[model samples]
Target: MADEMFRAPVNRSMRTLDRNSFRKVIPLHAARVPENKNISKVRSELERSKDALHQDRLGSVFPDPDRDRAKSGTKCVLLRPGRRKEATETGDNPHDGAEVTSPPLYSSVLDALLEQNIIDLVPYSLYLDYSYWTYHDIISAILPEDELGEVPSGFSQVGHVAHLNLRDEYLKYKHLVGEVLIDKNPGVRTVINKIDDVGEENAFRTFRYEVLAGPDDLNVEISEEGCTFKFDYSKVYWNSRLNTEHRRLVSTFKEGEAICDVMAGIGPFAIPAGRKNIFVWANDLNPDSYTSLQDAIKRNKVTSYVQPFNEDGRSFIQDSAASLLTTTQT
Candidate 1:
């Protein structure tokens, strides 16, 4: 039988059997053959076939184990595979939920491809899109007209940017200048040229004065509306923008309505609101603004309506529920 001959040892000189005869004899010795005989060779060939199939699925002639998701050790971010390319090209959400697209070709994929790429693979440098802005004066001062654009943009022009770059300027006259400007005159008004340099697409702004010149003391008193206030001078200067907005808000209040200015600064709005016959409670975090606010309140002669607070805004507001209500006994 063919199975018996196969187990016996294949001899080259043995007579060849026809296909039909070989098939007939295979069943005669089938029970004698061991189960574990050819499993290793079969598994190796099957793995080769699977690799080829996986490569083909990725549309490659040669199987690349790295780029092929099947061979990846990292967890597959299960997605509808074909839709990835389509979604990337169109910038549309593929998953139909709150799905967000990652940066094109994430670094993890790039790293895997780098490790698994075929022969003659050379790494490519990453390219980034950026815009740099600078003052024309600074750039012109740095280099000759012929050498223009050779130097980097001199300084950042954007306002309130976290990271900033300032180009080196050739300061030939600065050898003797160490802390030269001593009298930082806060009273001096700033001119436009001194404050900002006009540039393409951006304008820089700077403050002229010491920007903080106010009293430093905390004064607490109950306003006619029975609310406490504490003013801080340093906070008032730093938060100057809030002053204008507070002024606008105070203008909207109706006459005789009790209003509380929690976190008030130097009586910018509270004192002015009191002058308009509105009962005001002015409170501040800084002790200085509190004393100044109280003095300003007395100076303005609005003692009857404007009160001052020395405690935190939370405590004052928490304790002011009854005093805040203007309801009449029915």
Candidate 2:
């Protein structure tokens, strides 16, 4: 059985994210203490204890100003979920209807603090909403139990667009997964899933894709190596993951050297090299890529050093070499 506290209500029918359906109330043990100079020491001890709650967004210590002890300036230091045996013995079971229990803690530090009257263990209800869980957490819980471990959490971001290449098994839940991705990732306004493998549809490396969530806008702008590039994501190929390779290749070109990019895609190599005062003859067979390359050269203020060409890679290689040789001889 899934851990009830962290589990999202599974609804395979869910197309959009239903935030209200993810609300959960978890009962836990908290160390209540008076607000004084020694409070920091008490917190430090609790944090070091094996029983302390450790979650990403949820803090271990919280100030409940509206509680009865708030008038005397007291705070609650939360502990991890108690074992079924501990909860049942005290008749304060947090997992009321759940079968599985978290590992029981035998914290010596907590025992010593309790014996000294430094802290008291009290029941606290932790209310968790949609924002508490991360993209992985939410996706893992919503997907089928068998597919839980292989949740589609990875995606490439191009400006406001998130590109995903989902497996065939997860295609049915593509829209649902895309919706959750947008909810968790800020500034991501569009999500797309590649319907075909790269180069399978065309030699240009552009693939057919479906808009899983948000608008169908594919025009995006991204900055790399101090240069900005703008392109239509669906028409031309661009991979943010290749930024390192682009930089490594561009760094090798000398200022006065002539570089020929036979298959330049949106001027990743040519534009950055041109920025360094290298003369580049950039060519692409894809008309869209050629157009974007020209735009990028102008956008990055490298028009004088970077020249764009629309031709086959083989033809551009021979022609550009001959042109460069003629220019050098003159």
Candidate 3:
């Protein structure tokens, strides 16, 4: 039942799995200790799981603001180890032992954003480098070296993802997969290489959806509508400046005027005005963002008054410039 509920996303070509009959146990062949001679199989299994892992994360890595502030514009962000360390008063082994601490993501983005210091510049996700945990490190932690060829440890293999919804909780179960490492779903799983030149597969096998901090995670309640979409830092834009500029331009247009935005990111001003039955032409430079605007238009069902354009905003307009006939023809 648990496996069914946590089943991998649907795949188009792979055989449809019987939700009930699916078994996740390691094969007896797999259990046989992999001898140096069987290293090839070990490599294949590692590659398969690794590929599946990449498919799991769709590749959105956001950066952190707090850490961005600490580094003096340096590329290095001081990451607290996964385990906290305790030191003895005596100099010998002064650093008694270390316990896992929160994982530190790479500081390149945090550093870059801080250095730029642009308003509305946000990091919706973060990418982490966890390649340090090699296959050897993973295998050693999961099995005694001698057992590497015979059979992998029961719950100590290199590539099983425990479905823990929360980040910290996921970290707790990290050892089951060999190491306690955290990385952006995409960066950790390089799907292209993992697929080994095979055509792309639909759905991911290991991506876990987690709300690190939000209305409930932060202990705050927000209106249902506000909490629907996951807030990504990269989605933050400098709308305040544009809003002011838009207002200034539109102020002179009297009560009824046609408005068009070459680059409408979220339709913030476009939707509200369009609701008043004003004609609006909203477009976006990015396909994903344009799709989002299109969705917003559909959700609001403002298609009656709002027109969408998906092509390059400038080119689309220039081509239509001569044919644009805004006034009603008698």
Best by lDDT: 2
Model 2 worst lDDT window (10 residues): 83-92
What's the CA error at residue 213 for candidate 2, in Å? 0.5
- Model 2: how far residue 290 lies from native, Å: 2.4
| TM-score for each predicted model, relative to the true structure | 0.32, 0.83, 0.28
Q: What digit string (tens of lDDT, one per residue) describes model 3 on residues 1-330?
A: 322322323322222222222222211111111123433442344334331112132221112234643243312111211222344234345486644444333233333433543212222222222332233333333443444363322221111121222223223323333222222232121111011111223111112233221121211111111211112212312222244565555444433556667766556556555656666777766555566567667766677766777778778677433332453111
Over the stretch 245-296, how does candidate 2's per-residue lDDT look in tens digits?
Answer: 9999888888889878899989999988998999888899999999999999
Q: lDDT by residue for model 1 over 59-154, one digit each (tens)?
A: 212212234422442111111111122243333665665654544322333233234431212221211111111123223333345445544322
Global lDDT of each candidate: 0.37, 0.83, 0.35
Count clashing pairs, candidate 3.
24
- For model 3, the stretches where C-alpha displacement exceeds 4 angstroms are 1-256, 320-330
* C-alpha positional error of residue 184 in candidate 3 after TM-score superposition, expressed in Å: 27
Best-to-worst lDDT order: 2, 1, 3
lDDT of 2 at 40: 79
Higher lDDT: candidate 1 or 2? 2
C-alpha positional error of residue 232 in candidate 1 after TM-score superposition, expressed in Å: 8.9
How far in Å is the alpha carbon of 11 misplaced in model 3?
52
